[model samples]
Target: MTTVHERARPAAEVLEWGRATVDPAMREAVGALPDPVRHIAGYHFGWWDATGQPSEPTGKALRPTLTLLACQAVGGDVEAAVPAAVAVELVHDFSLLHDDVMDGDRTRRHRPTAWTVFGTGPAILTGDVLLTLAVELVAAAGPHARILTSAVLDLLGGQNADTSFEQRDDVTLSECVAMAVGKTGALLRVSCTLGALAGGATPDQVARLGLFGEHLGLAFQHVDDLLGIWGDPAATGKPVHSDLLNRKKSLPVVAALTSGTPAGDELASFYFAQPEFDPARAAALVEQAGGRDWSRERAAQLLRQALDTLNVAAPDTTATGELTALARMAVDRTH
Candidate 1:
């Protein structure tokens, strides 16, 4: 619900600080890679174009911000947790590169995907290098190294389920929810736990922070599902009707299908009968089945749960307040 004129937000300052601190280290990490791989990584980060021209950064770096916020929530200096933040961001980018490749997506971050520009083989290799680098970064963070690897396994499991869902019409809401947790929640959970650990939080605090992140991650994905079905391509930085074109069983779509309404029945017929989806008609069907409203309410519910969980963990502080506001914004985001 934020507009351009809403200059400062609860999490804006901390998130901005995180993006500033992490970018330099993130760039250096990418720079450390070998030639062609480094070049591809640079391009993916929007640091340089195919011809070495400078460009803009790709995303909001939300995962890194969450890491830094977790640090502050536990009384650690943001600078001290910079490496952990960078690690989370690196893994996120690694996932994005591989996701684009796997989904055959042409664009990301408002630019042609690396796989499209550098060829799929090179892009996948570059993603592999990034994943290795991410592990190395976390290994430097100490005993928590196992956590990052575990999260990666969960992330891959989620993505594997997602791809499988594409070929089947019998996908259940529970399966989709689990897939979302594995794909999206696992990393966010890792980010918060790693940050809390680096911040010297106790085991109890760290585990609680991770739980808060898991709820936030679920809310984040529900909003993402909303965006996929109804978001503007220019704002979302993707093609129009991107999910429907791929027949992605986003939560809203799942909700509509299981609503048992006539519109839901009609939508199912369209999904099964058509060779290619018509974005306009499909969108209309989803709306008719109350998909958008259902998704919005679900996101709000998850956001509330995240805030409640966060409260049980940390004391009332400016840092935790900002985190609460951020959890709210995560669900309300349009893109």
Candidate 2:
């Protein structure tokens, strides 16, 4: 019930820092690449000025900010966490580059996706280079680097299962949860872990941070599911109801599909029968299936659990407040 003012930076400041972190070395690295690679990766990050010169494409570097914040919260030096912070952001961008290709998505962050501009092969290679760079950055953190690699591997594993789930109708709720834990939770967990490592937290503290990140990550996915269905395109910057178009088996969809209700039957019928359903129809279908309400309520519950884990981490009062603000900002985000 604490107001945002009770803790954390004002939302605007946090957002500013988040955007600033995305621009530095990674963009420079991409710009330094030879020929088509530079142009391709440059365009992906929105750095191409008119005439395809390097201009800035903006991103909210949420992962890196979280890494730095968590490090500070645990009394770690933010400077010490920079490598991990940058590493995670690089990995995140790398994932996005490849994910767009795999999802056949044409746009990201309100711009044409790397694959869309660069073609599949070059985009894939671009992701590869970034991923390698990510590992190198993490490795510079010394012993903690191995854990970071494991986190990336876990992310890849989760992504694999997620894509596979799209084709399979029998995916259970537990399986969905597991997939989310990997797909989203892994990097977040690593972020906290690295933060605690930088801060010299005890093993137990690191574990608690991992749990905090896990719960938060799960909550994040649930919120994303909500946004995917109902968020405005101007705000979300993605095609409205894109999840439905892709027939993405988000948590809510899976819950409704397995509910054994009349609505569930209708949902299954419509989803399988329609190949080219639009946003309005998809929203109608989701409503009929009771997914809208169910998802909102479920996401709320997961958010509470996430907060509980943060509480258990028992960060400093200021850090706790900041994290709470972060939680609110994440779930309460309209954009």
Candidate 3:
């Protein structure tokens, strides 16, 4: 394992190290699943193609990296945090599986989605299996099972709200933000919280790190919503103007709809008028209505808040620097 003091590795390198450290444990957990479910899970995880041949794995390993780093930041042994790391990663993947199915997404990580290849039922079942595995893995860790289950419940609530928003035009910015907190922030908060617990952190330290994760998670969603509008298809593995195409009332879109600017009115007209509206024009309207700028500014602000919380936790100096690097990389990415 790479020590934080060994050298100042880039955030990307830290992520790679985190992934490498957790992969064996992750694989072992997955290996315990029934064969059919395991096959779909492996396919979704980029471990193999539909035919079971080997394939290059994809994923930034962000959640698990946060878990390990949070442990190290609190002066806990990284190895002690491995199960927590794997557990969170499983939960993340489980969400992705369900998200793709619910969103009608055809691709992820530049490959066809598991639902598209293995059938929807199988994909959903695999997600359920993975989520079960997460709970089972964490059951031995004191307090971790309860923490993870609570986060899962919150995540489900957020997903429910997200789906419900699609049928209505009256979604408010606050409501949308609350939904993002559940949909994205819950798991991230738990990632840090569980890691801190595993590392034997003080209650105050755990709470502070959890706060940091909450801020970072919301910031991540803001950036993700931006990318959903303008990110390159090659990088995001989604269609151009994907959010607009789906008419998703994402943060920026909701901001624009509620902006009360003429551009906002026009965007609303375009958005709710018909199913065939132009996505590019809608993107332009969102920017004109200040949605893009607002989201960008909010993400930057939240990044600062997250860093402030991290500092208040009084973490190890080297781990603090690496965690800061990871947070910046997360907020500043193109995809």
Candidate 4:
């Protein structure tokens, strides 16, 4: 059992611990894949370069960390949640592989995307394989499988809406919020739910934890959208004003588009125009139209709500503190 003092470890420490606990199993799971698919998956995971040589690792492992922590929060053994953590991480990477292809993105984690390095069909097939692996990992656990499948369906629906928004000019803030909920919140919610279930949480406890994850997930999206526009390339591993360059109908962009301000109007004009419309100027107009500040404030509000829900969930003291710290980190991060 983790002592109170040990449980009170800092958020970064907790993340590292979660990574160490989950990575071996993750690697083992990937090892079972066919050589070609495994190579592409490994490259996408930053486990190796395209040549199959070991490389520096990437990803924050936030979802899996949340899974482990949520299990501990409910007074369950963290080891029992390892499979769940691995499954969630696989699903996440699967989505990323497909997303890069659909978004026409050429880079990820400061490296060429799988679709760019390999062929698009190969990258997409690799994503399918990873998703199938995720399902196989939990196939024997009926409730767990159901939970994961539900979340995946929601995620796919969200991705569909997101892609559709690119060709649209009339996306509302509410619609954008709904999309973020499905795309980001659904998986995060499932991470906590699966963890709590593995830890033997009461139904009420699972519900409360799920709510916490949902709110935090939405908050995470707000911060991510902000980073997409303004974050440093070195930190974010993406170009400056990347979202603006894509004319993405992100939360902030949608907010600015619907703000009823003159800056918003100018932004709509600039944003919907042809390519090469000056991403820096588009970013400035988003800020001018109050999108940036609104997103910042919304993120803070959601963080508070998430913490408050977590407090009511009757989690262990150590879990509460660590979860609080992680929640804050999720919103406060620049990348």
- What TM-score, computed on C-alpha atoms, does each candidate reach? 0.92, 0.89, 0.95, 0.95
lDDT by residue for model 4 (123-221), tens: 999999999888878775445798899999998998989989988899999999999999999999989988888889999989999999999999999
Question: Candidate 2, which ten residues in sequence have the lowest lDDT sum?
Answer: 21-30
Which portions of model 4 miss their true places by more than 4 Å? 1-7
RMSD of 3: 2.2
CA lDDT of each prediction against the hidden true structure: 0.84, 0.76, 0.91, 0.90
Q: Predictions ranked by TM-score, top down?
A: 3, 4, 1, 2
User: Per-residue lDDT for 1-335 in model 3, tens only?
Assistant: 65444554689999999999999999988987888899898888889999999999889999999999899888899999999999999999999999999878887888899999989999999998899889988997665799999999998999999999988999999999999999999999999998888888899999999999999999999999999999998888778999999899999999999999999999998697786988999999999999999999999999999999998895446777788999999999999
Candidate 2, lDDT over the whole model = 0.76
Q: Given candidate 3, what's the lDDT at residue 274?
A: 88
lDDT of 2 by residue, 182-254 (tens): 9998988887788767777678778887777777777788789878888888899867887887788887878
Regions of candidate 3 where Cα sits further than 4 Å from its true position = 1-7
Order of all candidates by lDDT, from best down to worst? 3, 4, 1, 2
lDDT of 1 at 39: 95
Report model 4's TM-score to 2 decimal places: 0.95
What lDDT score goes with residue 180 in model 1?
A: 94
